[model samples]
Target: MSVFETGQTVVRRDVHRSGRVWSEQALRVVADTSEVLVAACVHGAEARWPALYAKARDDGDRSVRTEAFEAMAAGEWELAAAVWQETDLLLWKPPATWFSVNAFFVPEGDGRRLRNWYVNFEHPAHRTEAGFDTFDLTVDLVVTPDLTRWEWKDEDDYAHVRRLGIVSDTEPGPWTPPATRCWR
Candidate 1:
């Protein structure tokens, strides 16, 4: 149970890093910690985490937006057939198969590494209000070097959903998919 402060270096807890690292990576590592809800800001951090989904109310930094988008994109049912057709593959390993809009990424070596700040969308579920007309959906952000795969690992890995509270029906892409959950 190690706690990460704002200034500490960030490497995967599952993957260790050397002594020194990038300031952005360090920030991202701490940003990625569940300690802070990089997605919708309802999450807890030693300092503070604002409501990332509170578009009108949320005033969090870049990281918050990125996490929210990833958590929101997983189960878009109405247009699951079409939207799922365009989704990228999962990101994390087993137990944490994350899905969401490409939402862009930060460059890292030959790969596109995401900066912690931009990992979550500034908005929750990253769905445009218009998306609702088409489907009962939940978007998952799938950031990867290659964007040509689709799959699922866990049904409950969408832990961010629990924190996101409720999405407006007025918003496009219905809250839950027509099905239990979607997979392609």
Candidate 2:
């Protein structure tokens, strides 16, 4: 009878925790895109590093913790640091490299409507912070469409989205992401 199936499931907590979920998606995109786009992505996702850095600073790995502290202390953001001030979450001073976010939004009729958006983030892989060489990315999606766009005033990658707000821009744009049928 179906090899004695148990009608139950087993889940690994680590899969969702430890940044594995977001990290894996980030890595896959890094592999699929051209070299030029990668840099652009880093630019787009710069705003979220504050939260990530905070998370990294408290990392369980002794080496990672050390690296996080050093990164946060240097305070060298190439872009504006205003958002971090608003969020009140700081982790690293300045990182050698960084990654940014790209979110998908569906368009509405009249070419004007609100849509949900998400942000992705990543810190470069460094020996002190887990000993690797790649983008450690994470994605942050808005739960609702009314969510207004926010960022460190001068540090935005998109002139349109920053001014119109994510939903406003997303509604009347080339992007027309299809509805998800299932979780990837």
Best-fitting candidate, scored by TM-score: 1
Which runs of model 2 end up more than 4 angstroms from their true locations? 1-96, 107-117, 125-148, 151-184
Model 1: per-residue Cα lDDT over 98-159, one tens digit each: 32232334445776543321122113211122110011123443324354443332224333
RMSD (CA, Å), candidate 2 to true, equals 17.8
Candidate 1 deviant stretches above 4 angstroms: 1-47, 50-139, 151-165, 174-183
Query: Cα miss at 93, model 1 (Å)?
Result: 26
Residues 39-153 of candidate 2 have per-residue lDDT tens digits of 1121123232333444544454444433432333343222122121211111121234353333333334544333433333334333222113333222223334444543221
Model 1 TM-score on a 0 to 1 scale: 0.23
Residue 163's lDDT within candidate 1 is 41
lDDT of 2: 0.28
Taking all chains together, the TM-score of candidate 2 against the true structure is 0.21
